[model samples]
Target: MQLQPWIIMATISAFLIQICLTVESPPSADKIDLGVHPLELEHFVNMAHSNQVERSCGKYVIPRVTSRVGFSYSANTSFYAFVNDDMTARDNLKFLQRWFLKFPEYKNRDLFLTGESYAGHYVPQLAQLIVQSKVKFNLKGVAIGNPLLEFNTDFNSRAEYMWSHGLISDITYEAFTVICNYSQVRREIVMGSLSPACSGVISQVSRELGKHIDSYDVTLDVCLPSVVSQSERLNQPRGTEKIDVCVEDETIKYLNRKDVQKALHAHLKGVSRWSICSEVLKYEYRNLEIPTIHVVGAVLKSGIRVLVYSGDQDSVVPLTGTRTLVNGLAKDLGLNTTVPYRNWFQGRQVGGWTQVYGDKLSFATIRGASHEAPFSQPERSLVLFNTFLQGKPLPEATVVL
Candidate 1:
């Protein structure tokens, strides 16, 4: 995918800040009329702004900011609902809270937050905000698919698992290990080596998987099930030889996507760039308090739901990391295990598992998918939403972790 030059340039100038003047204003506690629809679809439906890519779904109109002029958010390539990285999650939350307050339909609807891979970070951040909103607004539940909520534990395990499973090449694995081992070297490598590593993985995996395929864009999670199923059935000489190649392809794809790179740039822009970890570390305002999980869990206890899921084959943020994050929340809630967990999707073998801590907090996994379940398995994704929207426990097919 071709990213706009301005975005590319903005990425290079990662530390440049856009200034905003803050004025103290009383928080509006006004409630809006609950319309049939929960969102202001019309505001986005006929967006006069030319740079945005808009798509209509039911009463919803999703817009993508394709180019950055002044201040911008959303991934720049394809149109998906991407939160802005330039601002703190708190800021993003405040924006959404005010939005719901302004639009009455959203007040009583089942509000949700979702994302994949790096969005893993976004998913929890938004969830934290929603919990805060519940004190004042009507909120439902939050669902995170293959999210990257925990960095050290979840992220490291994902990389190692992908390596052991042969999804990433030995060389790439070594490169990752080196980059992750030293802070300075890792930053230099991430900034410079991301594209090469990503492109190489895509090429190698596509070729090894199918000769019939022409283009290999591993970034699209939409391509997985068919590719994985077919490759599993290929009775050729090396039947399982490339079975997991897509994993490596996905890893590289995640690292190289211009939008994510843009996020990293946004995170680093205008900060001290002395360390490689600076890209992520520079986003000081985005940091969460250690008690965040507990605070979020407490809010959920008040009748809201929290569902965190991971794709079985995801190497970026594996099932274990999600499990760890949930465990933390569970501990905070102080329930030995009072909530019920069950199957949430059909057709796929018990998509991982789920566990509920009372009615407020829940967790589940999507089977036969990667980081992005909506992109990889829309039908199942819809099933998840259907259950959550109705405020029902995930089905029996979803295992209890």
Candidate 2:
């Protein structure tokens, strides 16, 4: 069978949506919704065609920065939702095959698979499946951020992250690491058989974390559900530098709006509302234990490029653990570091730290960004996105006299 022609697909399987085709341009902030992202689907097409991204910052001032953009966040993608999201990967793949069949134009184009969070699994697995089957389109590469690659490493790293970041007491950290962890607590919750010891440690951790914190990106503020939820009021970007912590709530409100759905040609066929996460779908939690880092190796062995990046500020999937795993993967694959680990620049500032291995595999970190890197640091994230797609290394830091 001949491979299909060109391009990419952005996965949001958690929400049962597959981005079809998306167009973007210079982002202008004329949004009325405060907590919501300034750019929305309603205006993105026009904005993208505008040809100039208004920039803000000191010294490294750029008024109309021109660079390639992607659907770095779902905020800018055109997507098609699976009729039923509560399905297995096999089922989803079959649906996607049919979806691909419908778009004959997609045949023969190089297809790039990408996503965040659990997509570390979804993206790689789907790419592997595409390889196994005779699919149209070339498998380009994969990029995932702050993803859950290994459950033990990813979840267990929280103790150190919490302690180092001053989110938990030393006593709490010791017990949390020595006694229980986010994964263990979760397993207990899932099995409906919480150990007394696990319960106590979990309760302590929860108390320490508090409900007001967005544990995903500890540096970012939490969305006040009372204020952002069920209200259309706009507020200042209170999350981080420009990230509105409550944007999560804002997205929900926007998607559920009847006018918004109508505009997107979307509807809640089997659900009451559009949700970023699926509530009805029963995920096999065991899948988390099966590390995709190995699957990443398999992809590399197949000669496909792999880029595993992290948002350094994410406590949920701390950079420390991801660094260890990525390094180990490089060693296992016998891939030598092509570019030594060092700071990369966006303009004159260190955007993040990156390391490339054997040209085929690379790892990098987005400095001062959140778990959702783009949401927290859009310009920096866009830089990374552009570089990754171009198969170019992040810009090297420049020396100033």
Candidate 3:
């Protein structure tokens, strides 16, 4: 199918999204052309569930355009939306307004908002817009993976996480808290200078963690960048049993291939090479200070199901911080604990821990999963995915036939 021209409006920044129905798809004359192994874009939510769509399941195909949080479009232009430091979540909502207007089909469908990392801010803000707006999108639920919800709670908790996981020493952890919190440390970084005290302690922390470690997934091995024979590197043994330490290496090589770009109808807007994150994007760091946890509460009050899941292995947005936020939120809302916290099973063995509050809100941990839980443990993540869509809780215990 030759592509058609898409009108370029005010563009937003770094995000890409693909939409696929969870229902099983039937073998039909017109099949959705899912990007193959070597052809998909890099830095995509790894092990993206859309790839698992079964041919036997009758499904609907929605355009998985490059998103700036909530904007959606067809895969016609590989060119990105250039957004600057001044661009806020409100600006993202404006772009989403254009997206919803363009695609009327999304009106009736259940819109479950989901994001990882930065989208922690984007996804919830967008869902809030849909809920408040006059435009009637079937905004169902929102899920965030290892999100940055509240700056103080999420960032400051790093000290405890670092200490609890044995990543740093008792003395170093004490210094981290006593000298200055992690948020202050990050603010100094954004300002392009660190205080002598901040620098000294940060250096101490780094030395303890070491260059070989991946703060993203503290247990997983860090990727070796100076790899030769790209194909051989792609085929080499992964650093950890559960996570692919070097998936980024393969992604970089694959996306840069000329054949791969053509197959996906992609083009470099002006750059010489395709990169994982947008080079042109200038994100507003202050937005991180703006709390979105209250926005999440608003979503739940409107009767939308909310699920906040964490990959237990991740350290950057550690499960410690996320779990604390979820627990606190449950209490603040006066939401009853429908299911007391307990183990949830994937098969015969335990998958992770889960709890449901007031039956509409859930929090879970994916054991040994990375910042990108679905990529590390696809099967287990899928089980969670199915339950999220069904508005059910993650099982407290496994049952035998």
Strongest candidate by TM-score: 3
For candidate 1, the C-alpha RMSD (Å) to the true structure equals: 14.5
Candidate 1 has its poorest 10 consecutive residues by lDDT at 25-34
Query: Against the true structure, what is each candidate's TM-score?
Result: 0.51, 0.76, 0.78
Clashes of each: 15, 16, 8
Model 3 pairs whose backbones collide: 15-67, 24-57, 24-58, 25-56, 25-57, 25-58, 26-57, 26-58
Candidate topping lDDT: 3
Candidate 3 residue 286 Cα shift, in angstroms, is 1.2
Question: Candidate 1: TM-score?
Answer: 0.51
Taking all chains together, the TM-score of candidate 3 against the true structure is 0.78
lDDT of 1 by residue, 1-401 (tens): 11111111111222321111111100110001111112211111110211111111122211111112111232432322232443434554555555556555545543444334444444455555656555465445555565555445664564455567665677666655554422223233445554554455445544443443312112333324476654553434533342232443343334344574565453222322212121221232223112244444654665656677766656556777677778777886676676545555454455445677766676777666555454344455555555665577655543544
Better of 1 and 2 by lDDT: 2
Better of 2 and 3 by lDDT: 3
Which parts of model 3 have CA positions greater than 4 angstroms off? 1-106, 226-242, 399-401
Tell me how far the alpha carbon of residue 388 in candidate 1 is from the true structure, in angstroms, after superposition: 1.8
For all candidates in order, the CA lDDT equals: 0.43, 0.60, 0.62
